[model samples]
Target: MLIVEELHMLLLRPDGRVESAVSGNRLYGEVAAVLVDLALHGRISFSHEKHPTVDIVLTEPTGNPILDTTLQRLVPMRGKRLQSLVVSPKLDPLEVVVESLVVQGVLVRGERGFFGWGSERTPESDPAPELVLRSRLAAVLAGTGAPTQADLSLLSILQNLNAARAILRAECGDISARDLKKRIEQLTAGSPAGDAVAKAVNDAIAAAMVAIMTPVIVAATIT
Candidate 1:
């Protein structure tokens, strides 16, 4: 599964509703994940400046419709700040991810409420994928295993979304929220001696966090 799909799964309830804590910014989280996935695939890269901009390294199709479509949209957006991509009215990463999951039979699209007055719901049709994903993340968070670059990227996006605690609470067992936060920080903190790929992933994730959080911070200050 793509990191973005895993993120969407984590954000959802068994009944298909988005977790309350992340409902407001779920799209942004998914968008960030998509960008991180692209970076991991070597299809994109981020600048090292204060406000990092995204640049497409390759325009070749990724075989995945969602990524391919997003890549096409990003063609004109090269050198744009991550914030722009995250908030772009034209880009609907969440919708694309959801559709992909539905087609993969991971999620079932249904409706709820009175005749025609209801809203659509996407309940889980298959729990196996998410189950495996959570298990890997649990092992990493529990310090029982090492985290891969994808793990760090997903965790970083969840942290910035302020949904990590709620999403991982059950899997984390008795681990305190403070400790979980610390562990995530330690894992995401790139090693100066790490390989170039790891460094690039870390940079992409960090740039994504700044892009995802800057507007919220600015709005809070203004209020």
Candidate 2:
């Protein structure tokens, strides 16, 4: 599950200045970060409240030899710099948005690019552009509630490691996935719903990935 909520992001630029504000909703910033983490580790787990604004715990990669050191650097800052960034091998940020929305069930892949889902299929079908959807999702996951079905659909895209990671880097600011994975492992260790929620979220992500990517992959290979 993505932790989408409004957060106070305070960026300390090179010149010893402090820039702070509440940004990054569920679809864009926060969900983007989770997607990046999932690509590197294969799955993620977090906690949710009865209402919105739940705290989540992420699991890190255990076997990867190179991840230990990276974990050390990232674990301490899990909710800080690590929370609002994405990391991916690909450079197209829109890809992440596209994949996420498709997986989450918001925008469906049509003959052309992504199109919004509805019976009418009018020009207003996709009321929010991809960028707006991303931003809104990030805000919701951060504890804000501006998210719609579209935002949830986009988040579902992270179920695929390849697409999820690619989208992460393209859209959100770059961060280290290996490090984020380690941090999640340490943070989510003791939660009550840790194990069950992790499995559920992972399962959902997997199902969504197969549902969407199988066709695309087969077509690409054939072409």
**Which candidate has the highest TM-score of all?**
1
TM-score of 2: 0.26
Model 1 regions more than 4 Å off: 112-119, 190-223
lDDT of each: 0.78, 0.35
Query: Please, what are the lDDT tens digits per residue for candidate 2 over residues 1-223?
Result: 2222111011111121212221111223334433333433544333343211112244455543223333333454454321222321221133343344445554454432237333222122232443464566446444355444334334443322323333444333353555433433333343343344443344444444455557989999999
Poorly placed runs, candidate 2 (over 4 Å): 1-175
Model 1, span 1-223: residue lDDT tens: 8888898999999898888988777767777778777877889987766557888899999899889988888889899877667766566587788899999999998787568575578899999999988999999888797787667777877876667888888778987778878878788775333234344444544565676678999999999
Per-prediction TM-score, please?
0.84, 0.26
Candidate 1 local Cα displacement, residue 200, angstroms = 8.4
In lDDT terms, how accurate is model 2?
0.35
Predicted candidate 1: what Cα RMSD to the true structure?
A: 3.4
Residue 16, model 2, lDDT: 18
